[model samples]
Target: MTKLLNVAGAISLLLGFIVSSNAVAVDEQPQSLSQLQSLGNNNQNISNSSLQQGTFNKTNRSGVLLPGEASAQELLPAAEEGLPPPFGANLFAGGYESERSDGLNDDYVVAPGDKVSVWLWGAVNQSEVLTVDNQSNLFITNVGPINVANVKASQLNQVVTERIKQVYKSSVSIYVNLLTATPVSVYITGSVIRPGQYAGVASDSVLYYLKRAGGIDSERGSYRSVKVLRNNEVIKEIDLYDFVLGGYLPRFNFKDGDVILVERQQATILVTGSVRNPFRFELDKDESIGTDLIKIARPYAKVSHVGVVGDRADGPFSIYVPFAEFAQFQLKDGDRVFFNDDIRAQIFDIQVAGSYLGPSYFAVKKDTRLYDLLAHIEVDPNLADFQSVYIQRKSVAQKQKELIDQSLERLERSVFTAPASSDGEASIRLQEGQMILQFTERARKIVPLGKVVIAENGKIANVLLEQGDIVHIPAKSDLVQVGGEVMMPQALVYNENATVEDYIAWAGGYSERANYEQIMVINPNGMVRLNATGALKPGDQILVLPKVDAKIMQNVKDITQIIYQIAVAANAIK
Candidate 1:
């Protein structure tokens, strides 16, 4: 008997441990059958007595047996008092303790048509199934339809005990069980990787539902404006960008039946133009700056005079700068850099060749003419071929045609003959890169030929010749030579019209050592000599013989006699 009692006690303790473990698992107070039955109130009422009796029978068989002398009825109460609350309540009221110690509010109560399961300790033979009706009440054996909804489980236990005390001799404990819960769900959509509805979502947080729906689509979604809708109304918008990067997730929590919507990303700026590579860059990060864009534009760009045409929200603005300056300047999106070649108009070069005074490259104004180029050269009057003068232009036929057309236009408009206007004449303006070659007709000859004539008083001599005309200079033997302390030495033609003074001038005039008194012209034909007044021509030689100091007086006398005789002859003629 002792061993049997020990075994029975061990079994009881094990059951107790199981019950305690179950009770500890309850997050909230155990709900009563009234709450569960109310969920299915329209259904048939379930009996609790049978369930309780079954529980009582099971406990009785597993424990110590009472004495044969002791009544089973008395033993039952003793047993009930010794057992947990469920057995005592079941013995009197066919129920268990409705009150629970777990922390939970009782404001949300189980209503009609609720299904509930009941468990009673030491009442294995009685019914433990129950449900609430549509009237928000549960019917018990001793206690009638008791209002359980909106009543705390702990409070309901006392109410059940009081009602059962009227029929039972001892106090009874009761337990309530709820088997159904309120339905709840939430919707997550818009820019989310997976947008859908989530059922059984708790009222605690929106993030739980969002996570279950999959996080925001970072590539195409905007974290800055995540909208939360409740009852079809936008209640709040959360910035997920801040939370994700800042490690602050608590700021965005969801409630039951809440809808979370991630918006799509907005439009961003695009950069192109004088850059190594042109592309569209996203403004997703905070590091996008104007200077950063310039770094990308450095290649494939002429840094000098980079032009930026900005298309902005307001109006368009244009900026130009050297490529270097542009790199130093901050750049922005939507700005286009246009690189163009600089066009200039100014002086240009032309080449001159052939028998020109100075054949070389010359710089002329953009609108210079062929005449302007020739004016610089010193043309030899006897050598230049004026009638054959021509300008050799170096250019393609097309260019030459264009030039001809322009020249004709100028001629027809009389622009060349027009007086200079304030703005300057068009014909005077030479086109850039034009070559002007001026030719001379006299330049083709190999020898020089011309006629020299002396004027009265021997003041000057003039040479007249046509373009390309050559004057034959007779060899030294075919000419007259005059020298002797003269101003200039001369070799003159014998038939030329030159006086003694003209010869003197040709010989660079007389020197201080010359004996001017004895000036004589020698003819190769004989020993006869002539005076200075005698006209000399081609093939004649004039010799101004020099005298020594000893013959000075004789020479002076002879000169005096000649002067007197010439004066007498001039007077007789008059």
Candidate 2:
């Protein structure tokens, strides 16, 4: 019987500890939910750090991987997971608190507990700073009690002056000023980060208290349904979007015990692409159309068309229409509207660099040919090498990078996954893998020049040019450059009769690590010849590639292939 009682006591203590641990409030009073959440978060962080430390110690003690840890590390994040954060989400980020006014507004009505300064100077010198009593009247020595409560700050001086004139008409100047306004304690509740009572002046804007309470809960709170309540009755409903779109916020003096409530989020639409504000917006009405959104979305570019996608009664539906018809289309909840400048313009701009005169950029038609542009280009015939002119394009560079990445990925997988028969072999494989990884990393940083080999048989190709293409007219040079594994890399005087080997020999020959058999001769137009027998030309460069020596023959072959690919794509020694 005693043992049973002891067990029951132990159980009661355990239950008490659990309940106490979750309690956020010191007593049985309502507390700020945001503060409670912060406290809980701190505890959670402490628990997580402790658990992680223990896990680390255990892992160190036993040299084996744990299932839970491995799975957690391997978890992959989804792409484009959720909608962009709602507009006006960052409105009440405590910046409004600094702008809080200490003075009362012109329209602010004087209430009890407010102080008013009254001075009568000319006829009778008298001054007194009087506080408004419960009867809403200010008592003066000469002019008995005057009802000044519920009076506008702008009209207070007029009212007081008129009352003083009744006593003394001539030589009596009255000066009236509001010394201080009554401080009101406002309750900020419902969908706010910290929902609690905050103290501020009666003339304080709703934003002042809202910011004091840690702003609105952006995800769950509605920017449209923020209500100012007095005695459980809503006096005003504020739509924050009005302030965000046009700098307009309604001026309403807060009273004591007034409540600032941020209601739950309403129906929303996601606006994306080509807009100044690409964010999810809450609808004022359920039946709102695309017209309502354009006012806030404010597409920065000329929106040619819009694509609307949403779940309808007929299942997922999508509509594509011109911007004119977009206003008539009614929107629903969770709809995604994409504004696109889809109409392809007739003219696009292309840049010209190197030996050229006049404007380097030309606005040409979409179907403009290379020869058509070259015809207009003014260049010095002595300086411009028109035969070796080439085109550099963005699309070509992207494609080259993609291909190089694919080859590197394949090489990495093959090298890392190769089986080891013994511990010594495994150690050797680890060192080789690290070296290969470093090489791949460095190779990935290489940006291909994306040179189009348009020059063939001393003639330039008259291919159709695309937007953003750079037309480079090579300047005529009388020097041949040799670099890479060469002992001395420099430019030599032009020798038309010199072969690839002759240039290398003149540049102090190749270093000990040079792959002599895999010599590369690169033309100014980014043409690669992988032999020593090619005819050397002025302004051409010769790169002596470094040889790869590895324990595994396959590793050597893979490394060699990547090195050669980098040379061809970038025309660099790497």
Q: What is candidate 2's lDDT per residue for 1-574, written digit by digit as tens?
A: 3433332232222111100000001122322212222333222112211112111111111212344422211211111466688898777755777665765789888988888999888869998899989898888887788898678899999988888788789998889998788888999999999999998888787777888988878788888999999989999989988898888899878888999999999999888777898888999887697788888899855566677767888897666666777877799987888886666655557788888776777766677766666666666768877667778887777777787788899899998899999997887677667666666776677676567777644556666778777888889899998877788989999887887788889989887667778888878766777875757888887877776554343466776777677767655462
Model 1 spans with C-alpha error above 4 angstroms? 1-170, 174-185, 203-205, 235-258, 265-574
Query: RMSD of each candidate?
Result: 55.2, 23.2
Instruction: Mark the regions of model 2 whose C-alpha exceeds 4 Å error after superposition.
Output: 1-80, 98-107, 119-125, 168-174, 231-233, 300-302, 313-315, 550-554
- For candidate 1, write residues 1-574 as lDDT tens digits: 3433332232222111000000001112323212222343222222212111111111112112235522223212322233212101111231112322222223334545445554333322234556777676768654466666655433655554455456554433345565553334678899776799876412224454555556555456655566888879998876543453355544332345678787775433333344444433333343344455554334453223344555566886555444445446544543444432222223445454333444355554445433344444333444432222222222222342343334334433442233545443332222100101000111111111111111122121122111121212122244677754465656766545656777677777766545577665533221224464666644455655433233212123332332222221111100
TM-score of every model versus the real structure: 0.22, 0.80
Q: What is the C-alpha lDDT of each candidate?
A: 0.40, 0.72
Give the best candidate by TM-score: 2
Report the C-alpha displacement of residue 570, candidate 1, in angstroms.
99
